[model samples]
Target: MRAYHLDAPRLDALRLVDVPQPRPGMGEVLVRLRAASLNYVDLAVATGAFPAALPLIPVADGAGEVMEIGPGVSGLTEGERVIPHFLPDWSAGPLPPLASRRMRGITMPGSLAECAVVPAAGLVPIPSHLSFAEAATLPIAATTAWRAVRTGAVRPGSTVLLLGTGGVSLFALQFAKASGARVIITSSSDAKLDRARALGADETINYAAVPDWDRQVLELTGGAGADLVVETGGAKTFARSLNAAAAEGTVFVIGFLSGGDLEASLFPIILKMLRVIGSNTGSVADLREAVRAIDATGLRPVVDRVHDFADATGAYETLSRGGHFGKIAITLEHGHRAQL
Candidate 1:
């Protein structure tokens, strides 16, 4: 089986090679990957920034068909489409211990392989409404958004502020809209702001024009601040997220796309009595809820670009440029079978 291997924990360690195909153990399933999508985590892992997740294939989320199931596995059949849960053991509620969560491409060999083994419970059935590439983006981005909204208690008539036009932020906008929240999106690009409005955002802010975007957000919400914030941009906008939150509001710190370091003031937190929450990846139940919400709302994953596995290096190059919107996908080769 062909897989991208990290020969050593260096930026240049990534290489394509034919390695032994993985087989499933008891209660595991071997998935024949049809598509895999890139997240910022893939970039960090490839660049050797995260030493904690060393010596593994990069990419945490993917969609594929079940080719085989291991002993004692039930309720899953051959040819069913599925995705790997980022936190397989976390069925619901709060995040599991750091010692226990096994991320697909980070801690373990991820979906970059032609075939990979995962615990059966870690595989969530993909919706028929989505293609392999579309469904591949769900586990991380969509699930994180679902968890953010659910944990932050987003409700109808609530006002929500979303940062950037990235995958998770966009999904957050979609979910907030479906729940009747007035959505406000922030972006450095005006064109992306327009696109976000088309997806039901009530208003848009160009963060570059008004670097103090929190004031703009407050103005949009009549100075009450937003009820919840889908804060995917990291340190560069953390202080702004704090400013954007309403009295007793919630901010879900989910990503650091801008940078990992943040500058924030303690005064607003104490005065407003706000809830500052952080989200990692979500549980299996959250992934299922994401599937349901997307299906119910008729929302589909937007593909900014697609690349075949044979030319994935070109895809990586294009992804590195960083102007694209939505998910970047690579379809896998066919004729691969899973062995349990």
Candidate 2:
């Protein structure tokens, strides 16, 4: 099997090499991966910003066909399409006490290869309406956004403020719109903001031109501000998210895309009675709900770019530079099954 490996604990050390294909062990399934998506965390893993064992295959989001199921695996079958849970052990319940230890690419081997062996219980069927590339984007980015939006309790007439046009923000926009929420999104690029408007964004703020976008958000909402803010920019934007939120609104911190050290005051939070919560990528149940909503609404995940497996490193570079508006995917070749 062809796979990219973090031969050492350095971002520049990612390399492609051929290795023996793995087979499913007891209660495990062997998956022939068709597509995988890149995440910022994948970059952290490669660069050793996130702790990982050496010689690790590194990518958390993937969708593939069940090529083989080992003994004791009953729910899955050969040729069935599936996606592995990003945090396999945190299946359908409250967050596990040891979630960090079970996360893919950190504590476990990930889905950057043509084939991988995962416990069958961790695989969820992909929605039939979604192509492999779209399904591949859901396990991490979309699920986290889903949990964030859900935590905000979005409903009809609620306003959702998104920090950027990245994967999680766009998915949050789609979900918020589907629930009849008013969606306000920000981006540095006017063209990207235009695209976001076409995708149901009620208002788009050019953060580059309007350095204080939180004020614009407040203006757009008639001083009440947004009911929910999907805070992807972390340290750099969390303060602004708080500034843009309604008095009783919630800010769900999903990523540190703009870097992680926060320097913000808690005075506004106390005055407004706000809720500031942190979201790791959600449970398997969250993924199921996201897929169901996508399936029902015919929503499609935006793929900013797709690179062939041979150029997986280039995909990482694109993600690292923050040049993409949506998920960056890597496609593999493995006969007819590879057409994801």
Candidate 3:
């Protein structure tokens, strides 16, 4: 099978190579990958900012059919459509690193290959409504959004503020709307804000033009501020999120997509009693709930681009561009089931 590997620092390290196909080891399942999706992690892995990573295959979350199961594996069947949980451990309710050595697309070989051997426990059923492209993006982005909203504890009609219209924020928008909360999305670009509004965002801020978006958020929410802020912008926006949040509201710390480095006063968090919580990718339960929500509402992933598996490098570069509004999918050949 041909797989993409990051040889060293530069993304020029990405190259196609033929390698032996893998078989499920003990407690593992061999999946014939149908599709894989890109994330900031993928870009980090490729460019080598991601440390403790072995020189290995790239691309994390994906969807495929179960082709073979290893000894002791059960409750999984052949030909079942499945997605690997973002974190193999912490299966039930919360997020935790599963084992000392297992995290797909990171500590281990991932699904960028034509086939992959994953722990049987990682696979979850893909909903009937989604295509391979849509299912591929779910385990990471969707689950992060799920965890963010859950941590926010927002009820119906509560205000939710999201930074950037990236994949996670878009998923957050959909889930927030489904829960009947009003979404306030911020983007530097008006065109992106327009698209966010179409997705049911009650308010939009061009944060590029208005740097102190928190004040704008305050004015928009009638001075109480947002009930939650999906703070992906990290240091650059953290202080602002603190300023923008409603008293006692939660701000889920998910990313530093804004390139990090911000200055802020500690008074707001001290006086308002706000919570700043960090969320890794969520649990299997969160993924399942997100899947059920998508199935129930027929809300599919918003895919901004699709590239053939061979062009995976170019696809990774697009994600760094920050222009994509949603998930980027890469299609792979079937390694298990025969196509007619």
Candidate 4:
């Protein structure tokens, strides 16, 4: 089988190479991956920002067909379409302490390969309405958004403030709207904000134009602020996120795209009586719930671009460039042309 391996902590180290196809072990299933999606963590691992074992497969989320089922795996059969959870060990409930360290693309074989042997328990059925490229975006981004919104207790008349138009934020926007919450999303580009408004965002802020976007959030809510703030920006925007949340609201931290170092005062959180919770993507069960929600609502993931498997590096480069509105995907099957 063919796969991309990051032999070192550099984007240039990702190279395509031939490897023997792996077989399913006990309680595992062999899947012929059709598509995979890129995430910021994949870029971190490729560039040494997030340390990982060298010379490993290099993408976290993917969808494919079950080709072979291992012994003791009875519920799933060959030919079933499924997605492998990014965190294979955390099946349900609160996250286990050690599960985050053993994740796809970082510690184990990931979706870059033509085929992978994933534990059966870690796989979730793809929603009937989505394509492989769309389902490939669900394991991490969608699940994290689902966890954040659910944790924040988003409901009708609630207000959600999303930091950007990235995968998690977009998923949160769709989910929040489905739950009848008013959403306010931010971006540096007006065009992206327009697209977000089309996605049901009640309001949009061009953060570059309005540098004091937290104040803008407060103004938008008539001084009450947003009921939930999905904080994707770490050091650069964490303090502002605290300012943007409503009193006693939740600040769901999912990413550090702007760098993770923090030097902000904790006064806002203390004064507002806010809850600051950090997310580690989500569990297989969360992925299952996310998929069910997508299925139930007929919600489709927003895929910005799709690259051929031979040009997989290009997909990573596009993600690194940072202008994409949503998830970037790569098709692993031959001649499987995907619409961007």
Candidate 5:
């Protein structure tokens, strides 16, 4: 089998090499990977910002077919399609301590290869409606968005404010719309905002044009502000997200694409009686619920770019450029073209 190994922290250290095909052990399943999607955290891993063991196969999200089922794994069989959960330990309910440190790409070998062996407990059946590339985008981005929206307890006709048109924000936009919530999406690019509008974003703000976009959000909501804010921009935008959030609303922290550290006051949080929730990727139950919702709504993940397996490094570079609007996927099967 072929795999990409991060022998060191630099993206240049990511090397493609042949490795022995792994056989499933007790309670584990061997996946013949079809596609894997890159996340911002993947970039962090490549740069050593996220600690990982050396010679690690780095990528947290993948979708493929079950080629072999290990002993004691009864619910899955060979030829069944499945997606690997990013965090193997946090399978359900509240996240357990130290689970993030043990996440697939961070502490364990991930699925950026032709084959991967994953615990059966962390695998979710892929919906029949989605292709491998689409299913590959689910485990991390989609599940995190699911947790964020559900944490906000968004109701019908409520408002959701998304920081950007990235994977998580786009997923949040789609899910919020599915739940009958009005979505307000922000982007520096007008073209991206237009795209968000097409995806059912009730209002789109070019944050670059309107630097005080939170005020625009308040105006759009008749000065009440958004009921939920998916704050992916982190330090650069967290304070504004707090400004744009309605009293008693929730600002779910999912990403730090703009950098993690923030210089902000805690006064708004107290004055507005707001809740700031830090959300990791998600649990297995969360993934299951997201899969059901995607199946029911026929919602498709927004894939920004698809790179051939040989160009995995280029895929990482693309993600680093921050030019992509949604998930960037890499196809692993030889001659298997990714559906962009």
Candidate 6:
């Protein structure tokens, strides 16, 4: 099987190499990966921002068909379309201990390969309306957004504030809208803000133009502030996120695109009685609910571009450049599957 490996903690260390295809262990399933989507974590691992065991496949989100099931795995069958959970050991409830250390594309073998062995329990059925490329974006970004919105209790007449037009923010926009909440999204580029408005954002702010964007959120909400703020920007934007939340509102922190160290005040959280929840993507069960919501709402994930498997490195470059409005994917050619 062909796979991309990072022999060291550097982007240049990532190389394509032919290696033996992995096989399913007991209670696992071997999936012939058809498509994968790039996330910031993928870039971080490649660039040494995130630590990982060197010389392993790297990519967190992927979708494919089950080719074989291992012993003790009974619910799944061959040829079923599936998306592997980023955290294979976390099926439901609270996150398990040491789960973060074993995430796909970070500590273990990821989706940047022709085939991957995933625990059968960690596989969720893809929504009937989505293709492999679309489902590939759900494992991390979509599930995180889903968990954020759910934790915030967004519903009719609620107001949602999303920080940027990244994958998680856009998915939050879609999910919040489908729940009948009004969405206000911010972006550095006006063009991206316009695109977000077309996707059901009730208000859009060019943060580059308005340096005090949190004030804009407050003004848009008639001084009450947003009911939910999905905070993707850390350090630089965390203070503003705290100020932009309604009293008793939730600030769901999911990313650290701007650096993780915080120099922000806690007065807003204390005075407003705000709920600041930190989310690590989500569990396999959460992914299942997210897929169900997508199916129920007929929602589609925003895929910015799809690269051929051979150009997998190019996909990483696109994500690193930071202009993409949504998920960037890689599609594998399964022409040789018959030979397997």
Give the 10-residue window scoring lowest on summed lDDT in candidate 4.
331-340
- Model 2: lowest-lDDT 10 consecutive positions: 331-340
Whose lDDT is higher: candidate 5's or candidate 6's?
Answer: 6
lDDT of 1 at 49: 61
What TM-score do all the candidates reach, one by one?
0.95, 0.96, 0.94, 0.98, 0.98, 0.97
TM-score of 3: 0.94
Q: What stretches of model 4 exceed 4 Å from their correct place?
A: 99-101
lDDT of 6 by residue, 1-340 (tens): 8999889988788898999988888999999999999999899999999888778899989999999899999989899999999998998998888735479998889999989999998999999888899999999999999999999999999999999999999999999999999999999999999999999999999999999999999999899999999999988999999999999999999888999999988899999999999988989999999999999989999998888888888888999999999989888865321111
Instruction: Pull out the clashing pairs in model 1.
Output: 234-256
Give lDDT tens digits, candidate 2, residues 262-293: 89999879999999998888898898888888
Candidate with maximal lDDT: 4
Q: Rate the local accuracy (lDDT) of all candidates.
A: 0.82, 0.87, 0.84, 0.93, 0.91, 0.91
Candidate 4 residue lDDT tens string, 287-329: 8888889999999999999999999989989999999999999
Candidate achieving higher TM-score, 2 or 3: 2
Model 4 clashing residue pairs (backbone): none
Ranking of models by lDDT: 4, 6, 5, 2, 3, 1
Question: How much is 292 displaced in model 6, in angstroms?
Answer: 0.4
**Error in Å for residue 207 of model 5:** 0.8
Candidate 5 C-alpha lDDT tens digits along 68-139: 999999888789999999987677877788845468777888979999989899999999989899999999
Q: CA lDDT of 41 in candidate 5?
A: 90
Which residues of candidate 3, in runs, are more than 4 Å off? Answer: 93-101, 260-262, 334-340
